[model samples]
Target: MDAVSKENEVRLRKGTSLNERLVLAGIAVILCLIALPGLAHLANGQWLGIAALFALLFGCLLLGAALFERNVVWIITPGEILIGEQRPFGKLHRRLIRDDEVSGMRLRKSIGKSVEFTLVFETESKDTLTSPPLPDITQVRKTTLQIAWLLQLPAPELAENPLDAANPRIRLGKPISFKRVRAYRALVVLLACSLSLPFIYALWSGKLSALGIAVWSLGAIMAFVLIRYLYRTSAFWIVHDGAIRFERLSLKGTTETDTVSGDDVEAIDVESGGRKDSLYVITIRLRTGKKIRSPPLAGKDQTHAVQAEIIRRLRLNSSGDA
Candidate 1:
């Protein structure tokens, strides 16, 4: 690469800003400060400060996340596109696609009209590569279209984005999507409160029975382990031209993705469970013995709709193996 090329590489990188990192670091500090009183109470043996324990753990995780939150970066060169991430203590995962290996790209919006969008890239061998759900679709689309032209693939139009309209019916089955962020937050908060209520009541009434104490301990453990998974954004599965891709953010801020070629997936399973509220979850079992689950499905209606659509698109609608 020449000097001019090196400068261009620097120019095109989608980078983590210094200000953004500072703000995250600031919030991490604030959370640690908030956890101090909880630690003091725990030191005094007031176990009632279990809420503070969860906070302290969460704060520490935030501090780590803030410190190492964003390392994945995209770079466009004169020849191809490069996507790379700097891992813990500075290990790196890097993939470079020359113009010839580039197949195609599309924009996916799960919950309509949102800042975050999933950009999918397909290779000649049908491998699926995805960008982490990104907030700046405008810039992403511009870069993607440039690359698409270089590879001689069809351009994914912004106006035809998934969020642009009611999802078209199968052959393009409407995607089963999680509700917007606010809805998920509300549901999580409501459940957390309900779980905590029994302990809170017992604490107030001064009737701390052995069973009551056990219940509180169980609830606290559940909250500490499950809250991160629950409160995080739901994973999304997108199917395009017979290839299916799944993407979600891990609690630690890395993207989790799984892709199965259309032919490799031998079965689609949908099972329903839950008390009063119907919880339907999906598991995709491959001929290779791998099982992939969709982000937990929370509501009755969403479960039904998503199951129907995914099965339909996969052309296994007639089989009810689960």
Candidate 2:
């Protein structure tokens, strides 16, 4: 690549926030702390030995996730995209590819538009490729459309702005997205709280067993700590250079910068659930009959905001012919 081409390759830079890394570490520490005492108590019995082994296994898993958190990164270069991910062990997983290799892209609108998924670059030579869920819908669409536009020499006939009535994009400074905890984590917290409440009530009434109450109390504390840690640490971001980034301190991180030029994107859509109160999903359709989905769904207002901003950028790029 020439100097100009190399410069164009560095379109965006996005990283996972430090807050997320702290949360992963916190969760790991709590898991180890909780498991240690339980494992020690099992030394005298055969069943306890087995239980200790399981506890140790769990601890290892959490610790591994915590350490691998540092490997997260999403980078988009002129010819390709790069996603860095955290694996079970201390290994870093990466996916790197160019626009020409991408088969197609589409934005998926899920139930009530409450959820959305993106599909990109399904190669004929391979049966399957793993795609992680992205939290920001607009970024997914932007990345998808950029890839599609970059691959084709000429643009399609689709409308540049599909929804004329929608408002224009207002630069919201830096994009922010919360990489919230998922269903399993929420369920564990809820169950722990539900089980602990009765024990506390019984203790207050002077009818509870002290040992039982202590166990319940400890479990409840762990649950609260874990949930809070997850919430505070999760985040996603998009920066000024048409880049899309997603990261969880411990779970997954991906970034795509140097998107296809705005002039090539044919249309964009911000969608949400069926009912008025449902969540939102953003979809971008390229001129090549390709569609791209954002990471997941967002609130209705947030979805609208991102969609408007992307469209605005596209328009501005056209006016300047940049």
Candidate 3:
């Protein structure tokens, strides 16, 4: 990754490094070699030959994708910001943001020990245009400040912590729904069923004994328990009368409500959780040191919005109490 600045413009470029490309190429070659014996069995119509075919195809696909990977370039001018993905032949994707349309720049950090910072452009319409993951906080801060200076925009301050950067949407005092939670639950169930296909096949083939039945039953029960624990049927959050309430509807059509009063609330922030920290959730810290968290939200933006709104309402209530 490198950035260049000229009299009238600044340009940032990033792409797959040569060493990474070489490593990928080496892996592809190994995969192809491993598939060679399986390919030879194709003449005898063996199942191994079918598996080999898939392996060879996958290797080729990986190699091709690496070769065609595009270099990301961001060109910032006084009038507009242009972001594009450049291939050897031409630009693959291009986006332009006019200066007038941009409200400000935000430095967003992912939630994890190995944190990544991304510079996001907040538009007048509340939409965000994000940059590629930056290498370090120092570089990202410098880059964001430079762009802000060039555009005559406010230089974004570095968040004291990831939670401090959480900003609520302008629209508050409304219900925030997690409609996608249901779809996510459905997908989990589908995946669990897909994983059980091998056991079902064995049972259908009459190869399972009493022991096999017990094993399958145990596996199914575990999967059900995990899925039930991970997801709720539906959920939403609302701020009303100086408190934030989280309501969850279960599969059994029972509604559970968890409300934290503004007086007891310490802080509201978004945190990453679930499966390698790929999902974000809203966490509320109480004065007593207990933490309440919502289900994995639909996306980081939504989670932050909820966090912001809850914090905003808490502040409003605190002022009222005073």
Among these predicted structures, which one has the highest lDDT? Answer: 3
Model 2 clash tally, residue pairs? 14
Ranking, lDDT, top scorer first: 3, 1, 2
Clashing pairs in 3: none
Window of ten residues with lowest summed lDDT in model 1: 1-10
* Model 3 vs. true fold: TM: 0.44
Candidate 2 ranges with C-alpha deviation above 4 Å: 1-19, 43-57, 69-74, 77-79, 82-96, 108-116, 127-135, 138-143, 153-322
Q: lDDT by residue for model 2 over 98-145, one digit each (tens)? A: 666655544444434434443334554553443343344445444444
- TM-scores of the candidates in the order shown: 0.40, 0.37, 0.44
The candidate scoring highest on TM-score is 3
- The models' CA-based lDDT, in order, is 0.59, 0.51, 0.68
Assess candidate 3 and give its lDDT.
0.68
lDDT of 3 by residue, 81-102 (tens): 8989876456579988898999
State the local distance difference test value for candidate 1.
Answer: 0.59
Model 1 CA lDDT for position 44: 72
Cα-based lDDT at residue 46, candidate 3: 94
